[model samples]
Target: VISSFKIADIGTVDLDTIGTVEAGGMTVEVIDPVADYAELMESLFDFDALRALFKSGFRMRFDAMHAVTGPYAKEILENRLGAPNGTARNFIPLPDFGGHHPDPNLVHAKHLYDEMMGPDAPDFGAASDGDGDRNLIIGKGIFVTPSDSVAMLAANAHLAPGYKAGLKGIARSMPTSGAADRVAEKLGIGIYETPTGWKFFGNLLDADMATICGEESAGTGSNHVREKDGLWAVLLWLNILAARGESAKQIVTEHWAAYGRNYYSRHDYEEVETD
Candidate 1:
């Protein structure tokens, strides 16, 4: 929800539009929708597990791209999940995202990528898009491609309590790489493939045909909610890492070795009108 309009261009918006925000020692109650959402997140996610995961030497970073999710990420990952004060970056809620695109990709998030490539990088790194639905995950020297990310998450989802019962099935967009299909086959569960758009998977999720759905567009989610959730994916990765006690690089390398890697890229082409 990072707005494209700058605060200087337009007058400041009333707090009512931002839902609820916590400032200083005093709590400011606005329209209260965000408060409800915060409570919902507490109920949905396992905070105790996250709390333990953040303890000790498990350092990490969540780049907010100077977007609206900045505040939410800081609150959840730092205050609630015990990720430490500096776990989040570019955390101020800016309307224009400080002129950044907020896509959570290597091109837009090149600075974060540079940090990950540098010697002083943390154990893990992640970025969430402006709307807070898409996520990009990286570990030390490795940058996990979106296709591989979904597959890896699907394979290790059971490590988390919410998905410990295991998924009934999984869904992926048509153009996505087949990495997840390998996991589905091995697990002996159904694999549903649909055309582009999250709406395409809605029916399956509602009917319980698919427990999780993802896309090559950096979207991922489960029946816990209908939409792709950036923080949800981040927390899932953290849980898996905590359970395995392995670095993200190690896990990804092992996964590719086991299942083989699927490499693909998106391209844009400009064309002339056809006769």
Candidate 2:
């Protein structure tokens, strides 16, 4: 399991209230995490299949938003998968996120959205939020909503090598749209609806009841890991694109044509006083 500790969160403690122990110095062990994560992601897809996409002059642009995922995206998308040297923009982690919010949404990642919708847009564009667990996916002129992204991933998951045997089931948070339910019904797989939290899907994944899980908040993951992996979602999208040989717009339009479209909208009221 992965864990994190924030030194800044530590509070002052009174020495008089507790006993102190004199101990030897501690030893820290560092591992090659980027290589490990890259290997794990690579294992989930067919190498040649992804290579073919790149070989066909498939252009990809990843905006890391100066978050923790920058190095990982650099290693996986560019170094390992053979994309261009500058395929991953902002591929450097910054303490202050370069004075921008590291949220992978239209409001936060507007630069990427603009470039993707530009005349010389790349074939694919993606961004990952801070801590690397949430993702935003944009294809050429289209911006895929988080709900639609999960649904589309579920429908075409089999094209990827890891999901070739197909998914056991699908799970989504309550706030997410029901687009994936259609997929589960068509595939004859269980569909689980849980409250809005990643922990809600943990049991389903651990029990093998769900192979894919997502939330409406730009998060999607599979049984591959216990937590939502932004890069994993991006790679799966690429795998699906590679196998289907269709543009993102084409795939989305075709999916809507086959599965029917779902309309969903959410509203949030912030800092409202008690009524």
Candidate 3:
């Protein structure tokens, strides 16, 4: 039920008929509809579902990549994810004034990768694809596989300052590694397995039955958002690491030792035509 908005076509509006003073200056015009219609349907930002996130104190940070939905997504995350004012950045249109394709892969997100691996790297770094649905997580010098990433978050959910309230439960996609399952088991909490999609996790989170969920594709979220979140996952990891007083590598290694290793690998097919 998450909704969004876009500021389409900004230009000058001729209001000569309104009889304004003769003074002329560059006037910026924006297109937005206050009412619903067949073509626009009153933009998703005008919905009520977002209020729930605000009520829950979930704040967000994102690596926006020139997508139309970037601004709207930021607004929702800030409103719901408890982001302080003026902290979000839409890293669109790169330094060269050219658009950068926003994909959350090691090679594709070169800028993000460098920043994460650089000397001044933030405690965490996350990014998403063109539409803001997928996610990639990096902690210090380590890049956490989405499967293990979500499991680690679930295992240490109570450590995050925001989630100190407590975690209700955890869930993951059927194809996701069993790391999260072990964490849930150890915590004496329930774990739900759904098909490989964010929609399935949405239903469980909406019901307040689960606190966190993730997929093998690197998407992760909690009760904070009804959709898979990129930056939120990154922040969650940072908060957990900060609270645990351990490096990301240490946390993962310790986790593997306790739950036994679940070595995971993936094979991707590209540029193939359907037979």
Q: Where does model 1 exceed 4 Å of error?
A: 1-46, 268-275
Where in model 2 is the C-alpha error above 4 Å?
Answer: 1-29, 267-275
TM-score of every candidate relative to the true structure: 0.83, 0.87, 0.64
TM-score, predicted candidate 3 vs. hidden true structure: 0.64
Residues 39-59 of candidate 3 have per-residue lDDT tens digits of 121131222332343343433
Extract clashing residue pairs from model 2. none
lDDT of 3 at 210: 91
- Tens digits of per-residue lDDT for model 1 on 46-115? 6777688788667899998887668777878888888989899998868888887888988888888899
> Candidate 2, residue 96: CA error in Å?
0.5
Query: What tens-digit string does per-residue lDDT give for candidate 2 at 1-275?
Result: 65975444334434443344333342233457788888888788876888778888999999899998999988877777788899898979999999988989888888899999999999999999989999999999998989999999999999988898999999999999999999999999999999988998999999999999998898999999878999899999999999999989898999999999888765645469979
RMSD, every candidate, angstroms: 7.4, 7.1, 10.8
Better of 1 and 2 by lDDT: 2
Q: Which is the winner by TM-score between candidate 2 and candidate 3?
A: 2
Name the candidate that leads on lDDT: 2
